[model samples]
Target: MLKRQKRSITTTLLTTLFICSLSITAHARRSGGPTPSITATPVVIEHIERNLSSLGSLKANQSINIAPQIGGRIVSLMIDDGHFVTQGETLLTLDSREQAAKVNEAKITVKDAERQLSYMVKLFEKRAVSQDELAAQEAQVERAKANLSSHMANLDYYTVTAPFDGVLGFNDLSTGAMITAGSNITTLDDLSTMKLYFELPENTFSEITTGTIIQATTDAYPDHPFTGTIDAINPRIDPVNLTFSARASLDNTNNQLRPGMLMRLNVVRPTIATLVVPARSVLFDGNDQYVYILDEEGLPQQRYIETGIILENKITITHGLAEGDYIVDKGVVKVTAGRPVKILSTEIAENHLDTVEPAGDARS
Candidate 1:
């Protein structure tokens, strides 16, 4: 009988433990723990105008290779590298001793021919000379005059002068160096104005035009910002790159900008109303870019966004989204689509002034 009583006691204890386990499981299911806390704010969205961007180079407005027109020994080099010169300034002189002598001899011959022609014409009037003799004298005068002009031109070719007002580069050919015609002596570049050349996509053909403003900067001069405009646009697009060339003209009168300097161009394209968003909120996945949209219950919905030009931390949303849509910036990792969210006090919304206000009650 005592053994029967022990078995009954053990059975009662086991049954009570099973009932307690069931009660705890039911209580835990009812509580479900603390949900993820997320914060959101309602902000008025404005569509921003998009700007185009490209890389370019600073160049002299005009540059020409200075070459001698006649082959001769360089007698003197009047200017060195980095020399500023004016138009018609003598840059160098070639050995023109032979040319000068020939010019003088031609002049003497021309004078003698003119005197002989005068005498022949007087004789022809008196019938003392035949028509054939008069013709010969006239021919001699014409030939001498032509020879004199030719020699004069040859003498002028011995001196090389600046074709325009500009700065000269180093004279690669030294004095007393024998140079042939068309050999490069130096480079003359007009730096009073600078021109930047860059190529853009064919889609910008209609949007860009003359007088469009541009902002430029260079590594050489970091402190200054160069302002310019669209001076010219190429009439045809390149078949290989499918891009058209664009030029920006800037005043370099102070000689601050130099040629061959790499530059960055901020070209503003035709503005179109676009939804703007903070760049940090956008996320990229493989080939597509996306952002998280907060639903009415503070849940997350994944959205793919097409991005346009990027300005600092802001980016223009070209497509795939609309204005006045709530975006979940923080707590995106913990939240999933269609899940209920409980907003906590630790999260903050961005880009909204009122949302960022310190949470302090005036009455307190």
Candidate 2:
């Protein structure tokens, strides 16, 4: 009877201990002790832009090397280096005392010829000369007038004038310096606007057109971006490189950009409304790309996705995602499919949200 009582007490004690262990296990499971914590953001529907990038060079809207049309000794320098000049403004003058004397002589000859022609006409009317003789005298008067006009035109060449409104450049010529015809005296550039020349592959010819927007950056002004429009496109592709040339014009009201500077161009293509997610949310597994999304039951569901262009830490989802879907934007590698997750907070994912205001609120 004593041995039976001892055995029954041992059995009861073992049963109580087993029941306590089962209760503890159930409590831990209900409280989610094994669930992983993560940050999540909703997929956004926004406009995604694609850009075509290329290198280019900046140039002045109009540039020219000023030279003289006639050779002579420089007598006066009307413009200084880097002077802003207007159209038809006198730039320099050459010594032309000899040319001036030739013009005066031609004028005197013209007067003499006119007097002789008049005297001859009167003599012919009185029968002092024949009709043919009067005609010959009239021809002499015309020849003298032509000679005078030629001399007058040659005298005008002694002065050089600006062809357009622009800023002047430096020149070696000075007062009393002898220069030859066609010699470069200086340069002029119109800085109110600038031009950019770049090339793209011939395959993109159809996509580029006049009035397309362009944004450009240069090392000289890295922080500032210049905007312009496509002004022209080459009609034929270059046979050597199979590329087409494009030109864009931008305002240079401040005259900051200079010719020959290297620039990087971004040609903005049309945008499309699409679904996007944070770049961090996408994961790569060999040839496949995927993300972890929260299902209706709050469990992780692996989703394979197709991606397009990426910009500003955001990526476009071409397939396998929808607007308003939630994805694991942070701590993606820590969780797997069907795993229970606890979202820590929404603050961390605020930046990845679509911030576009509704149309009704926009009007207000």
Candidate 3:
């Protein structure tokens, strides 16, 4: 009887220990700490835009070199360097003494011819001169008048005048300095507007058109961006470079922009409806791109996606994602496929869904 009791007690102790071990294991699994905390955002469906960046040059709206049409010794410099001039204002003058003398001689010849023609007319009326003789005398008077007008027109060439209203540059010429025809006396520019010249690839010809808006920036004023419109475009692509030229014009009311300055330009095409998510949600594995999305069971699920253009803090999802899908926005590093995730906050996801109105069921 004593041996039987000892065996029974031993078996009871072993059974109790086994039950306690199973209980501990169950409790540990139940407590498994807290799920991995993560922040998530909902995929938004809205209009997304793509911009084309290019380098270009700034030019004056209108620029020309001020020079005399005819060569002569500059007798007068009416305007100083950097002077603002109006259209038709005289800027310089050549010596006109010789031209004046020729004009005066032609005037004397005209007077002489007129006197003779008057005498011949009276004589013809009195029958002392023939009709042919009187007509010959009349022709002389017309010939003299033509000569005088010719000299007067030539005399006007001695003056140099502004062709348009603009600011003038410095000229090396002064009084008594001789200059040849077509020599640059100075430069004049209309700074009311500026032109930006840039080129785009031939494939973009169909997308670009007149009146397209563009934004331009320069190193001189990095903080300020200048807005412009497409004023013109080349009709044909350049075979050598396989590009087409485009010109844009912008207001320069402050005169801050100048010609020949390097400019960075951005042209945005029309916007299209696409699905987008925060850039931080995307993860790269080898050559494949993916993101972590919440499945029906509130677990992290790996989804491979194809992406399109990336702009600002958002990326366009071309494939493998739907509108209203929740993605891990932050703490994606701690997320693993098929693992339960504790959502720290869904406020961002809700806000995105509420703000972005669904345009359509479009992938890109």
TM-score of each: 0.73, 0.67, 0.69
Candidate 3 residue spans exceeding 4 A from truth:
1-39, 47-53, 108-149, 200-204, 217-225, 238-243, 265-273, 284-288, 299-302, 331-364
Model 2 bad stretches (over 4 Å): 1-42, 49-56, 123-139, 199-227, 237-244, 262-271, 283-305, 324-364
List clashing residue pairs in candidate 1.
none
lDDT of 3: 0.85
**Residue 281, candidate 1: alpha-carbon lDDT:** 68
TM-score of 2: 0.67
Model 1 misplaced stretches (Cα beyond 4 Å): 1-34, 41-44, 47-49, 127-136, 172-177, 270-272, 279-315, 319-321, 344-364
- Over 50-81, each residue of candidate 3 has an lDDT whose tens digit, in order, gives 67889999888889998787888988988778
lDDT of 1 by residue, 73-153 (tens): 988888879979999999999999999999999999999999999999999999999999999999999999999999999
**Which lDDT value does model 1 have at 300?**
64
Q: Give the top-scoring candidate (TM-score).
A: 1
What tens digits encode model 2's per-residue C-alpha lDDT throughout 236-288? Answer: 99999999999999899988899899999999899889898999889998999
